[model samples]
Target: MELKPYRDNVGALLFNGAGLVLVARRADMPDAEGAAGGWQLPQGGVDPGEDLRAAVLRELAEEIGTDRAEIIAEHPEWLTYDFPPELAGRGFRIAQRYRGQRQRWFALRFTGRDADIRLDADSHPEFDAWRWAGIEELPALAVSFKRPIYEVLAQAFGPLARALASAAKSR
Candidate 1:
């Protein structure tokens, strides 16, 4: 099935105390136009009448296989970015649906153990594989369009991650 680029969407970022962030690899899902190995935080579009926070939780469950995770913080405002023409689907350009996505950033804490991750729980798995990576490493791993957002995320979460690192050292 192909999405007609409705231009309306939402997503979230789940982080953990170890200073490691969860990232997923895109499934080689047909009609999806992006690099397969490219990594990103778990996220999906919001359903009609659904609250954004609920959408974030739903996506987390579907993508990361958990019904709940601790939300440490969230951006007070929404963050948005545009997709380059070449990176966009044909339908996206035809619909001209608001150009790109407007997402509410979330900072989540995973409460479950590593064994809890069920990568194949969904009808369409968003990721083929995943790993915990440094926040600073994300910009380098992300696609060009998402690199700027990674930079923003690094700045937004850098201090907390550092504090966690410092705490671990004192243990």
Candidate 2:
């Protein structure tokens, strides 16, 4: 039996031309690093009545300050994770009211330069820093609770990331 509804969320695994994925450190954890909490993908809640695709793009712009990306792939089904026991009763409304998040994951190919990523684009920014990480490095960089989701994403998108990276190398 579930305790509460899962929050509707969308996550973007943004790949740069070199096939490196974009990971950003949330503002709240500006100095955190390693598996306990370090970096995470660009993702956010889906607003009421908004399309998932649009939500992903909006989240990218909101979280990392760029929408210069093209959707290349999507996970076949929604994936979910639960909030850690310690955080479940915290003040965060999502954790308080939801089991975790039911996410639609998108793979996006970045078409802009590194300079285009400006975390300050939003006055109230979610992330304080950003970097392009190897796809395999995602799970290790994420918070522990989100590591399973990140691992699944790395597997689902690994081939595509490698292909894109190789293509970039050939040119």
Candidate 3:
């Protein structure tokens, strides 16, 4: 079988003032995979000609119901990850269109209170539950296929995460 092109996507690593990264439990993962309740960072496809910055912010609002965050830093390079064969054509509608995702990740500082987050804000909620987690915990919490990307993110964003945590503690 010929491999398809990767889908253009954006990912958000929303860090709260306390320096914890936001993760959400997918509401639609297949139970057979035993990853039905797996957690992941907020991510979504980028529209044609849409700015990456805009796409990240839009995805944040659409997925978690808040755009009150501000961009702090962005991954210097795009990261690509392929879907595990079992997940191909079984997860997102985008799965039917592409082999996997080529994502531009961003670190955003959550500027609003937890009350500002509304999982039900969208007609179709992607996540059933959300929480702030330590950045190092991302890889283990993410699904197997997405683990590599989350691992890279944890390293790339480590210093920034630490600085934010320090700032929060000082306040």
Candidate 4:
């Protein structure tokens, strides 16, 4: 049985062969607006029967449109954040159901080329468009509520990114 985190989300941060991390541009978002409009890593909530790691792998495929990615590493702990009272109650009824969210972040190395991506493959698209972004710029793309989580992801994934880079040089 999976010991799921209460109201927690799981997601993966995928980096391509070129050492560039993948991010999706969430166009047409009302609440996120310009702040949420920037590039973002693939993420999703853990389903009822799914484990945290499984959830992330599933999210990566569903959000970005591919199932072939290597799990490089993951954060030792879960990262968390909360939305403000104002925005929390608005936009989509489910948003107000929780005080905050805890996320398990994964680092994945995508072996496939960019042509393999399909953001709208799922019934509901989380992002309309996608692009590769510098890992350093992630925190800035997130909203205030999600910034803390992004910071943690950036910190945890930094070493993995470096390792990925070094490994590429040897090939």
Using TM-score as the measure, the top candidate is 3
lDDT of 2: 0.88
The ten-residue window of minimal lDDT in model 1 covers: 1-10
Clashes of each: 0, 0, 0, 0
TM-score per prediction, in order, is 0.81, 0.92, 0.94, 0.84
Candidate 4, 37-121: lDDT as tens digits: 5556788788888887778878888888986788878788877766566654456333567666677888888988888899878
Error of 4 at 141 (Å): 1.6
For all candidates in order, the CA lDDT equals: 0.72, 0.88, 0.91, 0.75
The residue ranges of model 3 lying beyond 4 angstroms of the native Cα positions read 33-35, 89-92
Q: Which ten residues in a row have the lowest lDDT in candidate 2?
A: 28-37
lDDT of 3 at 152: 99
**Error in Å for residue 115 of model 4:** 1.3
lDDT of 2 at 120: 94
- Candidate achieving higher TM-score, 2 or 3: 3
Q: Considering TM-score, where higher is better, how would the candidates rank from best to worst?
A: 3, 2, 4, 1
Candidate number achieving the greatest lDDT relative to the actual structure: 3
**lDDT tens string, model 1, 1-171?**
133333445555666658678888876523245547578888777778988777888888988788568777787766766666654464444225445676777777777887778888888777888888887887887767778877898789877777766776788
Preferred candidate (TM-score higher): 1 or 3 = 3
Mark the regions of model 2 whose C-alpha exceeds 4 Å error after superposition: 30-37, 88-90
Model 2 residue 163 CA deviation in Å: 0.0
lDDT of 1: 0.72
